[model samples]
Target chain A: MQEIPKPTIRRLAVYYRCLERLEQKNVEKVSSKELSKMLKIKDSQVRKDLSYFGTFGRRGVGYNVKELKEKIKEILGLNKQWSVIILGAGNIGKAIARYKQIEKDNFKVVAVFDVDKRKIGTQITPELTVRSLDELDEFVKKNKPEIAVLAVPADAANPLAERLEKLGIKGIICFAPVTLTCSIPVEYVDITVFFKTLVHFISRGIQ
Target chain B: MQEIPKPTIRRLAVYYRCLERLEQKNVEKVSSKELSKMLKIKDSQVRKDLSYFGTFGRRGVGYNVKELKEKIKEILGLNKQWSVIILGAGNIGKAIARYKQIEKDNFKVVAVFDVDKRKIGTQITPELTVRSLDELDEFVKKNKPEIAVLAVPADAANPLAERLEKLGIKGIICFAPVTLTCSIPVEYVDITVFFKTLVHFISRGIQ
Candidate 1:
């Protein structure tokens, strides 16, 4: 298996979105040039990025829109359904559960967990029922969710992350701005930190 | 002014966080190799990234922790304060308003806006007041805010974006997942679409 760079993975997502737009227009095929223009990126860079995987585009003609979309999806590991569990069931958690895009594919929100009794019995969405934090191990053991979104407060983040690690969760999308220490592999994406940094940048006016 | 790549900007954020950690530990200086090891990135890459602006590291010694951090912050435009406004006072909007990090620097969340009359007079935080959507133009003009965070639902995204553009807001960080068509210069970072793409790839097992 070839290793995909993280930046490249993000670009693959952008490319997938572009293909979706192309397909919606009933466009049969697209060239790297066309995609670059649509995405406001350089054509050669697009071609080079795609080439890192395989020759999805033909030299003379172009790429088949549907085929290219499917290939990029496959490359990004979006080919199958991935069951997801949301921990915390707080505002952020519920917001993610209600997020429309996460509902597509097999990326179903199987369950939500919170220690708060007021939230435990509540339902975030029709598909996601709130459960106790105690049930997390059992839930992961039974449901085998591939992703766990950590939406708990900053104080609870590290402990919950450790628990998720113990439960053998694959990937984690953390909302809290806490450094998670885990033995098991997990992708940590701190949205709060990401935005805060952006705000800092804009405040400074670097360029 | 040299163009700073987007990836480098993101990494600068990561480096900032790392520097905060170093400062907490009372670390005086850090070499590129040590920083790279701490970040799990290549040493040469770290050196190259810093060298983009100018040589910040000494040949043999290392970078001055405090000085290097300040330089990176200035380069990323974190020197000044930026007043930010959220367009919708919903769940996501309130979340952004309540986010702790945004309050640290000059990135103050001065006001929130909603269409609901009951919500209009509400306070999101001690610092932020929920105003009516009709007040956007006047409020923006009076405050001269540099950045706007669009936390309105997907349906209201584009229209609100246009209004923000008309109001001459500099940058936008949209939480909604709608495609934006803007005449003015705006920077958008869509959280929903970004996470969905992550789920897409994880499910596909592309890596």
Candidate 2:
């Protein structure tokens, strides 16, 4: 099996979001040109990116919005339920757990964990509670959650990440400042870096 | 001036992050090749990206860590203070206002706004208060905030964004699902899409 480029995967994620919007607006068909214009990418680039995944569309008609949305979701693994857990119940962690969008994308926060004894057993969201950190390995071993949102503080991040990896977590949405050295993939959302990047965009006068 | 490509800007953001970490650890100098490997980018890409900005180093010495960090910060506009406002006092908005990282980047949240009457006049953070949506225009016009964080719901996002642009906002860090069509640049952090992208990365066998 050939590996898809990361940029294409990122763009596919963007395309999926666009398609979902189109579906919500009751839009059925979307041409590559239209998508390109909306995404600010060249029309050819849009077509090429789409082609990398598979064929979608026929003759004069463009992509069917609902079908394309499903295809992208399936390609991105959103078609199946992904049991997820939050590694902290702090401000950012709780915010992510409370975020409605996570649940909408079929990524379920099965539980949240915190080292604070006071936080343990407290409900972070109605469906999820902050469990003790001690229970994490056993819980993950039993539940086989495919992903975890690592929202612990910087000092705790690396150690917790190692523990999670040793416990066989497949992916991590890390909010902490620390970097993890695990075979499992980690998607970092370093707020300082992201905000600084935003500053850079505004500074460079925007492309 | 030649326009720097966005991927370079994004990588510059990554480099800035790496440099900050290096500075924290008291590292004084770093070669482009070393920085490139640390960032998972090619060595030439690092040099080329930095060259897009300006000259940085001498023959054999490589980049001076503090000087390079400051240069990147200046290039990214972190040297100057940027007045910012939050468009919603919702969970995400308040979390962003209190993030502490934003302040570290020299982006100040001057105020927070919401359509809800109950939320208006309430303290959002130690420095910011929730204001009425109607007050946003006059406030922005008076304050000249360069950036706005759009944390509003999908339905309200478009209108509020237009209002913010009309009030002369230079950039937006939009969390809403809705896309804004303002001439000023917009950086999106659509959680649903981002999480799904993370899912795709893991699903694709973790590059």
Candidate 3:
């Protein structure tokens, strides 16, 4: 199999989102040009990115929006449901647990864990409660959530992540500012980067 | 001046962050190999990325931690203060407005605006208030804030962004699921991407 560039994979996710909006608007078919225009990506670039996964569009009529979206979802492994756990019950953690994981189908929060005794056993949402850190390994073993969202402070991030990975967690979406040194995957996020990157892109606006 | 690649700019920001950590640990220098190992980028890739911004280190000695970090900061223009506004008073909006933008040093939220009458008069922080949407134009004109975090829902995202751009707002970090179609710079953030993309990355783990 040909390895797609990381940027191309990220762009595929963006294209998936665009296709979804198209589906919502009841727009069925779209050419590569339309998709490129909507995303401000080059038309040739779009074709090159999609070519890594088998071809999708008809020559003249373009591509079926629903079909292309589903194909990307399957390629991305989003078609499978993924149970998720939040490793901290901080503000960001609480917010993420509460937000519906609709785009991620099966990827929904199954539990939230924090060290704060006060927050432990408290309800994050009616659907999930803040569990004690002591119960994390045991609960994760039982339920087998494949992913964890690490929202602890930077100081606590590495330790919690090491433990999460030791307990068989496959991936982490980290809100804590620290970069993890784990063998398993870690995606670091900071709310500020969204702004900084925006400014950078603006300073060097699109070609 | 040479135009840097977008990915290189983003990586420079990451290097700035990594160097900040190294500075805290009293680590004075880092080889491209060590930095690449930490970030999982190729050693040559690190050298090439840094070269785009000009020579930063001795070939044998690697980079001075503090000096390299400061250089990246200047290159990315993070050395200055930026007044930011939040365009919504929702949960995510409220949280972003309240969180100190101290790390992005000087990238602080100066005001928050919402169309909800009840929320419009409320105080977000002792330092900030939730002004009504009607007051946005006047306030922006008077204060001249160039950056905004768009936390409004998708329905309100487009129009508010359009209005913001017309008023000369330069950059936006949008949380709404909808994509913005504006002439000025807009950065879209859907928190859900953290998990979905993590899953995607883990599914297609490094080559």
Candidate 4:
């Protein structure tokens, strides 16, 4: 398998999403210029990023919408469904559970776990049922979810992340603001920092 | 004013957040090595990034935690509260309105607007009241929210963003997956793409 840079992978996902819109609008093809204009990126950057995989676009005619969309999906490893388990039923966790993007992106929220007994047994949606953290080890061992989302408070983040790491979980999406150091080779994306940056950019304006 | 790279700005935010944690733990000073270990970044990179602003760290003694934290906050322009508005009052919007990070980061969600009558006039929280899209123009004109968060669907993203642009909103945080093009200069951060990348990195493992 070919290795793709992380930044390139994110651009591929963006391109895939853009193609989805074009496909819905019945647009047949998209040039790098068009894609760049819509995405606010340089056209050369878009073409160069796409060129890493193969020549999916015609020089003069641009890229075939349907073909480009599929190619991006295949490249980003989004062609197959991945099961996701969200830890913590707090505001952030529940927001993610109800987020429409997860379903659109083909990630299935299999279950939600929280330490609060009051939240246990409640339903996020009909598809996702809340369970106690006590069941986490058993559920993870039995179900083997591909992705684990950490939505617990800052105090709980590191310990829970360690627990997820021990469970042999591959990926962790952490919402807590606390910094987590993991030796067990888990990938973590911090949403609090992400949102903070978003707010910072908006307030300070991008340079 | 200096032009700071977007990635650097993001790192500054992360450092600010980390420093906040360190302060709460009563850590008076931190070396770049310690900060890097805590944030999972290279110590050299951390020092280089910090050097862009000024000589923040001493050669041997490292950095003063509280001083470094305050400096980052000042550099990122987070010392003042930023007024924000949510374009959609759906599940995600409501969750953001109730999220504690907004308050922690000193961002105030002044209002939430949606076209759905069922959701309009509903209270997300006591501070944030739901308003109709009909009032979008007037509310923006009157309040002049510095940051506008696009939580609307893909199809509605561009149009709503355009409206926000015309109304003189400075920055936008896009939650929709679609590509957005705006006449007014806007900083677009796709939360969906961020989460998708997190999931991808976790599932595939980051090298």
**Weakest ten-residue segment in model 1 chain B by summed lDDT:** B184-193
* TM-score of each model, in listed order: 0.81, 0.93, 0.92, 0.93
RMSD of 3: 2.3
Off by over 4 Å in 2: B54-60
Chain B TM-score of model 1, please?
0.89
lDDT of 1 by residue, A1-207 (tens): 466666677777777776876788899989998788766668988998888878868986899999988887776667677778898876678877876766653467788899999888986777677999998898899889878888887679878888787787876787766556654444555654455556544554542
Candidate achieving higher DockQ, 1 or 4: 4
What's the lDDT for all of these models? 0.74, 0.82, 0.80, 0.80
Candidate 2, B129-187: lDDT as tens digits: 89888887788888899989998888788777787778888888888875676777888
Better of 2 and 3 by lDDT: 2
Q: Write the per-residue lDDT of candidate 2 for residues A1-207, one digit (tens) a residue.
A: 457777787788888888988898899999998898887878888898888767786657989999888888888888889988998887788888888877888888888889898898898767888899889888999999988898887768878888888988888888877556666787777766656677777777773
- Model 4 spans with C-alpha error above 4 angstroms: A183-207, B183-189, B199-204
Top model by TM-score, which number?
4
Q: Each model's DockQ?
A: 0.30, 0.59, 0.51, 0.50
| Cα lDDT, model 2, residue A188 | 75
Candidate numbers sorted by DockQ from highest down: 2, 3, 4, 1
Which pairs in model 3 have colliding backbones?
A81-A106, A82-A106
Q: Which ten residues in a row have the lowest lDDT in candidate 3 chain B?
A: B97-106
User: What C-alpha lDDT does candidate 2 achieve relative to the native structure?
Assistant: 0.82
